[model samples]
Target: MEQLTFSSAQEILGFLDSALGRDLLLVPVWMRNLAYRLACLQEPDNTALLRRAASDLQFVGPDWNDTAHQLLRSAEALEAARRDGGLGH
Candidate 1:
């Protein structure tokens, strides 16, 4: 598999949108989860993307429980940051 690189949320969302438009099952679950994870990292304050990433990771199976938990934790931190006015947007 090629290394996935995403610099911005728009780029990540565009890639995800395109992948979702096609037969997503054709893509491996790991790849899909990785894309979502990267997107979440790019926009950590985006609760929707973070939750989506966590959900996708959970779907990858029991082996990913730790990672999924971490994503959820990150989402919680992001929420706290938002409430604290630490995030600009």
Candidate 2:
């Protein structure tokens, strides 16, 4: 994940667009959710990407399963902050 720092929202979106499985599922659900979570943290569209989080994929997680759940919580907090007017677009 560290090697995949995205340059822009489009980069992440491009990856996601390519990964849209036949059943509409992304293979690595954690990656997909992480991207969306990062996007939601800053993008006006919520699902749009930004530089803050995606610029460092290292922050995604230290491990896979349980760590992903923790990252999701942090990402969710960012979203909540945005909703509460603590973060700006």
- Estimated TM-score per prediction? 0.71, 0.39
Candidate 2, superposed: residue stretches over 4 Å from native: 21-26, 45-89
Per-residue alpha-carbon lDDT of candidate 2 for residues 1-89, written as tens digits (9 for 90 to 100)? 55335535566666666766343444465666666554444353442233333433334454444544544556567677888998874
Q: How many clashes (backbone atoms < 3 Å, residues ≥3 apart in a chain or on different chains) does model 2 have?
A: 0
Candidate 2: clashing pairs of residues: none
- CA displacement after TM-score superposition, residue 89 of candidate 1 (Å): 2.7
Assess each prediction's global lDDT (C-alpha) against the native.
0.76, 0.52
Q: Give the best candidate by lDDT.
A: 1
Q: Estimate the Cα RMSD of every predicted model relative to the unseen true structure.
A: 2.6, 7.8
Which stretches of candidate 1 lie above 4 Å from their native place? 1-7
Which residue pairs show backbone clashes in model 1? none
| Residue 38 shift from truth in candidate 1, angstroms | 2.9
User: For candidate 1, lDDT tens digit of each residue in 1-89?
Assistant: 34466356667777767877786576688678767767776777788788878887787689888988887898889788888999876
